[model samples]
Target: MHRCLAVPEIFSEILKDILPSDEPRLNGTLTSDACHLSLEGRPVVESSEELYQTLLALACTCKRFLEPSLDALWRTVDSFWPIFVALGISERDLEEMITRHRNPYYPRRNPYHPHLSDLSEAQFKELALRLIIDADYNKAQYYLSRIRIFKLHAIPSALLWAVGELSRKWGSPLLPNVRELHLTPPLTKDYLIFCGRRLVHVSAPLSADSPSLTTHSYPNFDSIYIPADNTKDTNDVVSSFIKNLPPMRVIDAVGCNSMPGTLEVIAAMSSLRSLSIGKFPDLSSSPAFLSPGRLLPCLQELLIGDIDLDLCTQLLYALEDPSALRQLHVGYLSTTGATLQKFMTTVATRCSPICLTRFTVSSNGPRRSADAELPYSSKIQPIAVQPAALQPLLPFVNLEYLNINVFTFNYDDGFVESIALACPNIVTLCLNEHPEYIKSRNLTLRCLYPLAKYCPRLESLNMGGFTFATGPGKIGVDGLSRTWTHDERYDVVPGLSLHFLNSSQVGVIDRCLVDIAAYLMDIFPKIRYVDYHPLYFHIRDVREPGWNDWK
Candidate 1:
């Protein structure tokens, strides 16, 4: 054994790398965001039984590794089973308690909780007390004291009864030092009792019948994550819970429904730094219901998933002082080009330009069947996507990522040039036009010239639909840059950063595949992948020399 192994910092880092933080799991499926609950405390890492045994052996074998080994072993646990096992509870009793308490309300999903018929309230309390009395208190405390993060997947009534009894007996919580807690479905009011004085954050689900948590539950609470509830009319329950909570620093209600005062309740939280909501209620008609308070003064990131143009405009109005905001994302159920233009105009006037960096919006409605398109009115005129729609965003000089997906957009070389000059720091620019609802698109292959010329930092580009320029004369970069500025003419070569080119619905020009490939290579010398439509392959053979040359 080396002397460096005795160093606590080195040993802890090694242990953490070997047993990383536990990835949140919902019925065995991994979530999309691993660090979703990382705002309040450290990530809860699950140490496997085998690793725990190894650490125990090392601790028993050597004095230098004893304290560090024990600390790593009991830092975080996936469930409460290990605590009972450590207290000398028999395996037979544990199995019986779990099997008999399978919840009947959601038998298919939550099979570890009790049904009403299995045990009456008194009977459940009695059994929980017996188990608690039979277990060794000293042994349980030895391990529980070292635990910092705890996750309860399923809470049986008996477990809650036992926890309440233990808290009452000792005059404090069983896990008194825990800082972060995570819970799964079937969440009820009883779970709030576990919020010890030191606890700072909690993550749980919200259901229609679930009870609200009071402000007195935890004195140090700072952040919360309420997973979306699938039940009907859950807004009232969620709103009541939010209304009762103390001022929070972060609130993430991604898939939850919107109520009348939901935004108002959130806007009143002056300390909020990050806020994400599923939708905004339509309050355009009743503007008086909203307060005139300074909303989210410390806000940094705002994400809205599904909203209409009217409510979105109202939300901007609610943000009286948005100078601190950094990111804004808005997704629409459906909207027209005129509405989108008006919304952009509002955003330009409302949101912070200097601090904002990322702006993303999606307006195309949900997918519909082919037969469902009959009711769509052709009387509504089509609007061609122009540089003016994006001109308002040019004030955000620090913008790095811009993504826009709407019904239709007519792309041209001038449109590309406008974006390239407006946001020179942009890293990812995606101008996706909905393929289902096609309109006139005049973009040509020459549009790539401006991107490679002006946006030197750009790495990815997607022009919805485009065609190659046709002519009797040769097509080259020189002809495209004839009107370039004196400063722009210095670096006439392709950009070294761009690697991905996404161009679909490519219309062939004079069957000049060789010239097209050469021109693309000249503009984006570092291109690694080019995405084309299936129809492109049908028009031109995949085995052609032009394609092979590009590869």
Candidate 2:
């Protein structure tokens, strides 16, 4: 019943189906030879937009294509906002779409519409609410109000007002989640008062004309860091702020100026566990507020920067029971031989037996030149530590860290040996020698050899301003020319000598590594993490004879 058609006949049939039957024909000629050809295989859609246009075109073409095209068009909508604007949709459209399919992705809406800047506030509010309700509440809160996380600069009042209103209405019971809150100048007393109860962590920058916004009932804060920019108003405001704080755990008054009643109030806060006071101008003035006896009884960590040694000793002595003081950091502004010895002796005796886990002291004065000579022996006191004197520090066997700054030393071997013997369990040790002393005569390896012998558990060691030699003959020399040409190889100690590196000089670093590797291969076998600072070379246990392969 069916007859196979030729190619020409098939082409004519396709043209007839595509064009209208009423169309005029050219000379009634059979133009099937000029007809367009269909390619083999399936049709390929170009992109999402092209697919959507194709579906829309199909839907307009005939009733047979309407259902499939509409289905494709609806499924191509990625977000509610785009679909809404595209379809000229309203809030009711959103409601219907959400009701039918409850799993639509809704993007955050921008309150200010770019296309309709002239829209009234009521319209903006309605649109904002609709968008807000569709978005996940947890994510919307970040943009909705209270906390301003981005842009440290000041915020405009309109945005602030909107955020504040939203916060008061919907952000109650739960505090705003912000990492840092900085309240600066130009803010009124009412603004500060309103933010005080909601903010849990705050940094207030005070100015001369700034109002003292200290309220008796303050926010439930856990930490406060105040910056004292050398201003009278700042000092006054800081004092007032501390007076009104809830029982806090940490307070950092690192650079605040000396306030009349500030220190006294801080000392009385029983809940403070850690405190730092740095760069105070007058330590010897003996203000009524400086009472360590009342202040530091329960402190677990205390850091006093750039204070006179005498004042430091006085403060340390004030803490009659320093059992709770586990960490101490002091920066010496004034140091002398007698004062230094007195401070060290006091710590070794009075505070050593307690749980003092870390101790650090630094002198920030300029280093003397290499050519500068040390004071004469007649003016220098003999460096000696009697055995009975060190008995008090035997209780510090549990200490894990120790750092000391030595400006002048007698270069006596016994003194270094005593330190190494006293703190055998130290894991981290930093010994900073004055540059003048390192460059002076009598700087010896014999003095420091005790460290490698005594500190078995030491994981990190820093020795600045010193030279390293290959053999015992050049141990006491000031220059490297005396130590480089030794014939015998040195054994590097493991666990004993694993992480050995010098940040001093190239010649010193190279020679030290050569000797250290030899020592490790010959004497200590468990060494790892050897760093040669000048060469920027690091060697670990995975590679044996690590340095020889390097060109």
Candidate 3:
């Protein structure tokens, strides 16, 4: 009653239900009755092309299968292609795809039935440019153009030059669009010349004779970081670079021995907002940089290291008005008790009323007494404050953050109280590595309750090296003690709390973890994150031969 069907015909019907219809080969082959019968028992197509063929057969059978098959084929494309195949994509197509989406990769084509028409010349050129740079340069360039951030770690000169040339040729006026550029390089001149106008933020280790070094117009640049290794002549080169970059707002010259002339140039840059002279030679010792108020006028944030009170005083006086300086950080510097007292007294009187908002002072110097021979029986004499002391900072009533490190045999409660009184608007306080005098005479948690009561807006408190009250006979307890509990009268301030405890020894670490956990749950319930730096634990499991198997 019916004509016998071939293997191909049977197979065609089965594949129509399983695969999409756009695939061409199977559509043409399955028409014969013998082919249908041959494929009758097969359940699945094994390879991509086989699947594609099956879908093509379905598409030819009915127009309804065409759209779905095309969609499935396009969706499977990804970035990984063989070396030769990636090189084949044309530049124009690549650019078109990149402009439409952040990432673009090619779809697979069968070797026997190649579809080369899809590839464009533009896409190929773009790919070629990237390939010529870093082995991974194509991906890096994609991120740079699309994401606006790039960190080029040790780029080779030849590769850098090639990419620069390609960028110049094809890039739009704002084509590169790089916002942050961190380049550690064996860079060439061409690379720097190409990058100068486009880069807004830059971090690099530069040398005076570096071929990539340039003194050119760079209007958009806002931040620059120079290593402190620059020689005297190199300082001139840096100054020349700075002159070209008028928009620069921040400079970090940590460890760079900047020339005295460079300091003058820095002071002259009215647009400079923040500066760091960390761990450099004492600029204060050089009369050329210190005389006639050689300080950056517009600088709102400053970080200095290994300086002295005289230099500090010089800086305060150099400012058009000390009140305008909002934030200050001094570290690894030494100042005599007399000099420190004088400086503080001056700040209390002058900067107390105006713009200074933050202050941080620290030192690693040895502790000694101003007057060591005085015994417990003698009356303490008030230190005299000179007129020059009053010439420095007026008290800063609007001060928001204050961090002080005092190292001395005698701690003075009056000094701490004075600072707090001067900065009534304080929001954050950090006191650490103080001398024994301060430790012995330090204000207790109960004594500092006034700060919480008065400073309602306070957000963070750091009482460095804090010890809790211990047993009845002991004056101070370990951090775990429950003896020092907050009362109903005390308000719960919403803020971060940090505790530093001894964890170097095994016994200490075990004890500390238990105490720390208990304290966190009971006393400091507001903590958001815990950071533990175990000095004793070496993490032997990571280096073990069978670590992967163990996991």
Best by lDDT: 1
lDDT minimum window of 10 residues, candidate 2:
33-42
Residue 113 local lDDT, model 2: 33
TM-score of each model, in listed order: 0.64, 0.54, 0.54
Scored by TM-score, the top model is 1
**Clash totals for all candidate models:** 4, 9, 43
Off by over 4 Å in 2: 1-163, 171-220, 227-240, 281-293, 365-395, 409-417, 441-457, 469-505, 520-551
Considering summed lDDT, which 10 consecutive residues are worst modelled in model 3? 29-38
Model 3 alpha-carbon drift over 4 Å, by segment: 1-147, 156-158, 171-175, 186-190, 193-198, 210-216, 227-247, 279-295, 348-354, 364-397, 409-428, 434-462, 467-497, 502-525, 529-551
The per-residue C-alpha lDDT of model 1 at residue 347 equals 80
Off by over 4 Å in 1: 1-77, 86-129, 132-134, 146-149, 284-293, 306-311, 334-339, 364-384, 395-397, 412-430, 438-551
Question: What tens-digit string does per-residue lDDT give for candidate 2 at 411-519?
Answer: 3346546667877767676555455554532334454455555665665554444444423543342332222222123353324322223334456556565444443
* Per-residue accuracy of model 1 over 34-118 as CA lDDT, tens digit each: 1111112222323345655666676786776776566666666556666555556665666555555545632322244434245
* Deviation of model 1 at 201, angstroms: 2.9
Q: Against the unseen true structure, what C-alpha lDDT does each candidate score?
A: 0.61, 0.47, 0.46
Error (Å) of candidate 3 at residue 483 is 17
lDDT score, candidate 2, position 192: 44
lDDT of 3 at 360: 65
Model 2: lDDT to the true structure: 0.47
